[model samples]
Target: MDSIINSRNRCIFGCSLSRLLSSLDGVIQNELARREPSLYQWYSSNQNPLVVRTFVNTFENDRRFNSATAICSEGKPMDTSESDLSLLVLGLFCLAAITKLGSAKVSCQQFFSMVPDIIGRFMDMLLEFVPISKAYTLTKDIGLQREFLCNFGPRAAVPKFANDHGLEISFWIDLVQKQLLRALDREKIWSRLTTSETIEVLEKDLAIFGFFIALGRSTQVYLSSKSHTDSNDSINSIVRCDRCEF
Candidate 1:
C-alpha cells in the first residue's frame, strides 16, 4: 500500500508538471505572437526547440531562482549551496541562449538588455569557484556585450554576441579542466582536507563540480541523441569530460 501510494504521488507530480509546462508555453507563445510576431514565428517553427523548451520547462514558476537572483543583485553572500548551484545553472542557460538564439532572424534586444546585468553577476559568481592564480585574475572584468540586431545593420550583432559567448565558454572550459583535475586528486588530498575549514570549502567545491559533471554528461547524451555534429570542439570537450571525472 505504501509503495502504491508513492507511485501514485509520482504520477500526480508528473502530470502536474506537464500541465504547468503546457500552460506556460501557451502563455509565452501568445505574448510573443502579440509583441513580436517574427520571433513567435521563428520560435514556433524552430527545428530543434528542445533547448529553449528545456529552459522554459525547468524555470517555470521556480521561486528558488527568483530568490537567488534577488540575493545576488544585493551582493549578499549566497551561502546556501542551492543558490550557488542555481546561479551556475542560470549562467549556463544564458550562455546557451546566446549560442542558440543570437543569430536568429528576429529581434532579441529586449531580452538581451534584461540579462546583461545578471550575466555580469553570474560571471563574478563563477570566479568564486576558481582559485585566484596568476593565470586568472581574481576579479576579471568580463561583461556580456549586448550588440543587439537593432544597434547596427541586420546580422551585425552576431560577431560581438559570439565573442561574448566565446569569453564565457573559455572561462567555463578552464574552470572545468581545473575542477576535473581537482576531482581526480581529491582522494590523494583526503587526509590533508581533514581540517573543518578546508573540508567545508572542499565540500562546497566538490558539490559544485559534481553538478557540472552531471550536467555535462546529460548535455553530451542530449547532443548525441539529437545528432548535433557541428557543435564547438571546446563545448564538446566540456560535455565529454563525463568520462574524466567518473
Candidate 2:
C-alpha cells in the first residue's frame, strides 16, 4: 500500500541517521579514550549510547518540504537564511555537551564562543522588529552583545589551543549595551524605522523567538523530568503595549 511504502522510507531514513550518529559517537569515544581517559570511561559506561529511534510519528511531523524561508540581510537580501541556523545548531550541541560532559571554558570553549555570537546577532536582528518601543529597548539591552565575538571567536579551534582568544561574556554584554545606546541616540536610526516597518519585522522576530522558546521549554521539561525541582526563569517577559505602535 501507499502508506506502507512511505513508512518503509521513513524507517530507512531514521536508520541512516542512527548509523551516522553511532559512527560519530564511536569516533568521539576513541579520541576521548586517548586524550581523556577518565572522560572516556564515563562516556562509554555511564552515558547511554546515542541511538535514534523514529523520526516521523505523525503526518504533521513529516518533513517533505523541499525548501523553506530564511531571514536575509535587510540591506543585501539573500534567497536563503544562510549560515545562521547551522551556527545556532552547532552552538546548542556545545551547550548540551557541556551539560553532559561537566566542563566549562576548557571543555566547552567552542560552544561558549559560538553560542554567544548566535545569541548576540540573532537577538540584535530580532529587536528591530518589536512592535513596542519599550519592549524593544529592554530586550535589546539584555540580548544584543558580542560584536567582537562574531569576529575574533575561535572557529572550530580546540579549547586547549584557543582558550585565550575568545571574549568574556560580561565584556560583550557591556559593549553591546553601549553600542545600542550610541546607535539609538547619536546615529538616530529610529527615523528609519516606522510603525509599519516594525509590524513587518514582527513575524521574523517571533519565528526566531518562538523556536528558542520551544527549545528552552523542551530542555526544561527534559531536565525537570529527570529530577523534580523549581525551575529558574530563563526567559523574561516584556508585555507589548496594545495602544502603542512602534
Candidate 3:
C-alpha cells in the first residue's frame, strides 16, 4: 500500500515540475514579449554578459564622484560633496541590480514594472509595524545618539561626514515617502493615509537611515572612544575604520 501511494505522488510531482520548467522556455517568453511589447525585448538582442558586468563594475567605482573635489572639464578629478557620494552610492547599487537582472538572466523590465507595487507593500509593512508616537520616540533617540557621536569625535572628518550623512538620510527618507505617495495616485488613497502614515514612513526611513548613520559616523566615534575607553580589549574592536563594500 505504501509503495503504491509513493509511486502515485512521484508521478504527480514529476508532472508539475516538468510543467514549471516548460513554462520558462523561449516559446512562452516570446509570447509574453508580444503581449507586453514594451516590457520585454527579444533575449537574443542582449549585450554580452561579460561586457555588461565590466561596465557595471567601472560605473560603480568611478572615484570622480566619490571625492569631494569636482572633476574638471580637462579630465581632471573634481570635488564631490557628501550629497553627491550618497547619491552615487544609492544610484549605483539600485540601478546596477536592475541592469544585471535584465532580460538575459531575469525579466528585468518586469521587475522594474513592479517597483511601485513593491513600494506599496513596503508602506503597508511600515504602517503595520510602527505607529506615530512610537516612531517619534525612535527617531528622537537616533537623532540624539547621532548628535552625541558627532560632538565627541576627536576629528573634523567625523563631524563633516556626519553632516553629510544627515543630509542623505533625509533625502532617502523623503524619497521613500514620495515614492509611496506616487504609487497610490488616487485622491481617495491620500485620504486613506493621515498623519499616522506620515509618521510611520518617517520611522521606517529612520530604521534604514540608522544603518548609514552608523556606517559614516562610526569611524570617528570609535577612534575617539577607543582611545579613552576600550584600549585594552582589542578583540572587541575594529582595527581600521572603513566603509562596508557590500
Candidate 4:
C-alpha cells in the first residue's frame, strides 16, 4: 500500500513537471523565433552530438567575442559593460541549453542549477576588466550569497533586458504560483492550512522561484539587441564559433 501511494505521488509530480516544462519550451521557441532568427537557424540545423557537446563547452570558456574585440579599428578591446556582457553570456547559456537538452528533457532542477555556474563563468570573464587587486575583493563581495545573487547577480540583469525590449514575463509568476498550489493540493497538505496560511506559505516558497523566473522570462534579450549594433557580429560569431564546428 505504501509503495502504491508513493508511485502515485511520483506520477502526479512528474505530470505537473512535464506540463511546466512544455510551457517553458513554448516560451523559449516563441522568443527565439521573434528575436533571434539567426540563432534559431543554427539551432534547427545542428543535430550532431559532438557539435552539441562543443557548444556546451562554449558555455564555459568560449572567447570568440574577446577575440573579435581585438580586431576593431581602434585596435583595443571593446569595452563591454559588466551588466551588458553578463546579460549577453547568460542569454547564450540558457538558449544553448534549451537547444542542446531539448525543452522537455531540461528538468526544472537542471534549469536552476545553471545559476551558480553562470555566476562563476560571468565572474571569470569579468575579471578580465578589473585589476588584479580587486579580484579577491570581487570574489568575497559577490560570493554566492543568496540575497545578493538573486538581486544583483548576472541573472538579475535579465529583468532589465526584458524591460528594455518591452517584454512581459508575469506569465511565469502566474504559472509557478499555480504549480505550487497544485503540488500542495496533490499531497493533501492544504487541509492543514487556513486561506491566509496557504497564501503565506505560497508567498514564502514562490519568492525564490520568482527571482529566477524574472531572469528566465527573457534569457536571450541581450543577444538580439547586440546582434544589430555590433558590426563585428559578435553574437553570431560566438554562437557559430569554431568550438561548435562539426
TM-score per model over all chains: 0.25, 0.22, 0.19, 0.20
User: What is the TM-score (0 to 1) of candidate 1?
Assistant: 0.25
Stretches > 4 Å off in candidate 2: 1-31, 35-106, 128-246
Which candidate, 3 or 4, would have the higher lDDT against the true structure? 4
How accurate locally is residue 241 in candidate 3, as Cα lDDT from 0 to 100?
15
Note the Cα lDDT for every prediction shown: 0.49, 0.37, 0.39, 0.42
* lDDT per residue (tens digit) for residues 1-246 in model 1: 544543443344335334434654675687788987787777767833867677665665576466445543567554554454455545545444554555343244444444444444444444344422311331222122232112222322123335454564355455656566676576444343454367777886566656656877776775466454326776566666654443
Candidates 1 and 2: which is better by TM-score?
A: 1
lDDT string, candidate 2, 12-128, tens digits: 433533443465566667778888789887776656443212211221243321111122224532223223322222333333443345435334343334444444443333323
Put down candidate 4 lDDT per residue, 1-246, tens digits, no spaces.
544543443354335345545665565566678987676666646644567578556644545344422323365433334433433334434434444564356545544444444444444543344532243344444333332234334442354444434222232223233444455456444343334357777675555445434533333344455343223333333322212211
Top candidate (TM-score): 1
lDDT of 4 at 109: 54
All-Cα superposition RMSD per candidate: 22.6, 22.6, 21.3, 24.8
Given candidate 4, what's the lDDT at residue 118? 46
Please report how far candidate 2 places residue 228 from its true position, in Å: 56
